[model samples]
Target: MTTLMTVLGIAVFAVGLLISIAWHELGHLSTAKLFGIRVPQYMVGFGPTVFSRKKGDTEYGVKAIPMGGYIRMIGMFPPGDDGRITARASSPFRSMIEDARSAAFEELQPGDEERLFYTRKPWKRVIVMFAGPFMNLVLAVLLFLGVLMGFGIRAQTTTVGSVSDCVISQSAASAGKTACGKGDPASPAKKAGLRAGDRITGFDGRPVTDWDTLQNDIRRTTGPATITVDRRGGDVTLNADLIRNQVAKSDGHGGYVDGQYVSAGFLGFTPAAGIVKQGFGDSVGQMGSMVHATVGSLVNLPERIPALWRSAFDGAPRQPDSPMGVVGAARVGGEVFSLDIPPEQRIATMLMLVAGFNLSLFLFNMLPLLPLDGGHIAGALWEAVKRNLARVFRRPDPGPFDVAKMMPVAYVVAGIFLSFTVLVLIADVVNPVKIT
Candidate 1:
């Protein structure tokens, strides 16, 4: 049964992956058509076509490989400086440029002269290229908001789960030294008679509904305070002398890291965690944190390649923060499904994973490098800048920047990306990250 569930999870994730790819291509196709650009083929994969249907002027199809997709827009590049498509070249780099130009004009119909992508205004071209990544971004935000506001997330509540027996510093407690020392004193919560399952209602005469606020208030107050609790259908009040102690505070990224401590009033009670719906503001804030973390991860990717290589070949354990390819993500989805968790929780987690994937897609594609949407946008913006500068100086308008000239650079970038992808794939298979 567990194996079946894992397979089912993988199948579901595969479907979602295909849908995301299709959706991404649809953004390009729709925007290109809207701008009167002739997109000859709208493909959802890179390899040979498995299924296709020619409708109107475009051939829509699904390919065998499900990794990525594209829309072949006519005349992606403007003509050469001579105002005509350049002929074949002898040099390898020149051949790459000519090949790109040929592909851009291969399906150019007679009337496509006006419908070419490069003929459109710079702003329109920007929109056409930006639409794909923007779609992924929108999907990510919607999914994140849906999960956060609708299904809620697992978080600590005001109800007490455990009370510490003795006052221990945060660093000491983290090091598996929880036992009371000879000179240690009882924790404030324990000394105040707080017990498990007691739902904290008020702190220091102020009503508290959530754990964060209650925790902050407790940390700030250093003197005696009234603690109101709802226990056994009765309101109970107790006086507790708060003590100044070292505690681990939030690092603002949903985690508490070492060396980030503060001197605060310690309650020494662990809050019970449960699924709690978040407000729109809180959801947005969480999304911002996720974006920040994702960007940091991408920035640190080069520094992590050595570790990844070691894990792939040296039998080293996979780091939790290690980068994952599609295979790793699908394996994680399978693990999430096979976990001994409630169905709703599993579904929510799976959705969150997909949402994070989409967010990463958006961020990854937005890098201003060739073969990506952001690269084209950058080209168009550069062209606009050049033309505007020419106009300011009372000079001839430098026509659309010949983005085709950057074919060599684009090839190098693509090769590096492919190499990195293969490395991640090998690492993912060899040292797959465990859910635990």
Candidate 2:
């Protein structure tokens, strides 16, 4: 039964991925047509076509590979320096440029001279290229908002789940010495008569509504303190001496980091957890933090390649922060279904996974590198800058920027991306990251 559920989860993710790819391509097709560019094909996948249909001037199709999709716009590059689209060159780099220029005009029609992509103003070209990634960004934001406002997130509450009987050093706790022994001092919570299921209401005369703020308040004080709790529907205040002790450090999200200890005031109680829905402002703030974190991950991607290589071949443990390919993501989706959680939680997690993937697509495509949507946008912007400078200097029009010249660089970037993807695939299969 678990295996079946896992397979079902993977299938669901695959469908969502295909939809995302198709949606991305639709943005390109619509904006290109809107700008009067002739788009000959709108494909949702790569490799051999499994299904296709001709609608107007566009042939819509789905290919065998479910990785990515593209739209073919006619005359994407301008003619060569010799004013000929069929020009041949001897040098390898020049040949790559000429080849790209030729492919851009391969579907040229009788009236396509006015509809070529390169013939449009630089601003229009920029819009056509930027629309695709922007679509992914929009989808990501909507999905994230849905998950946040609809399903809510599991978070720590002010209620106590467990209380320690006696104080012990973090090192001793790590070594399986958690049980209270002879001569052990009673913990502050225990001495103050704090018990499980008691809801913490106030600390030092200040109201406590959340666990994180309460935790920070506790850590900052070390001497005499008062804790107010709601017991049997009555408010009870207890007095105790908060001792300075070695405790595990928090991970900044109401969770503690393993093997990381610091000297702080110890409260000796674990907070309860519950799903709490967030308001629009809070959800937006969380989304902003996610975007910042995702950008940071992309920036530090190169530094993680060596670790990925070791994990793929040396039987090393996969780091939680390691980049994951589509395969790894699908496996995680499957695991989400197999876990013994409530149905709503599983669905929420799966939706969050898809949302994160869409967000990654948006950020990844925005990179100003060749073969990516951002590269074309950058090229168009540069052309606009050059043309404006020429107009200011009272010189002849410089014409459209020959983006085909960058084909060689694009090929190199594509190769690097492919190799990295394969490495991630190997690591994912060998030592996948586990949620548990």
Candidate that scores best on lDDT: 2
Estimate, for each residue in 1-436, the C-alpha lDDT of model 1 and write its tens digit: 9999999888878887888888888888999999899999999988889999999999999999889999999899988877778666899998888889878999677888899999999999999999998888888999899999998899999999999999999988788997899999999899999999999999988999877788889988987999999999899998898999988977754457777788888878889999988889889999999999999998999999999999999988899889999989999999999999889888898899889999999999999999888899999999999999999999999899888999999999999999999988998898998797
Which 10 consecutive residues of model 2 have the lowest summed lDDT?
247-256
Query: How many Å off is the CA of 25 in candidate 1?
Result: 1.3
Of candidate 1, the 10-residue stretch with the lowest lDDT total is 251-260
Superposing all C-alpha atoms, what RMSD in Å does each candidate have to the true structure?
1.3, 2.7
Please report, in order, the local distance difference test score of every candidate based on alpha carbons. 0.90, 0.91
Q: What's each prediction's TM-score?
A: 0.97, 0.90
TM-score of 2: 0.90
lDDT of 2 by residue, 35-59 (tens): 9999899998899999999999999
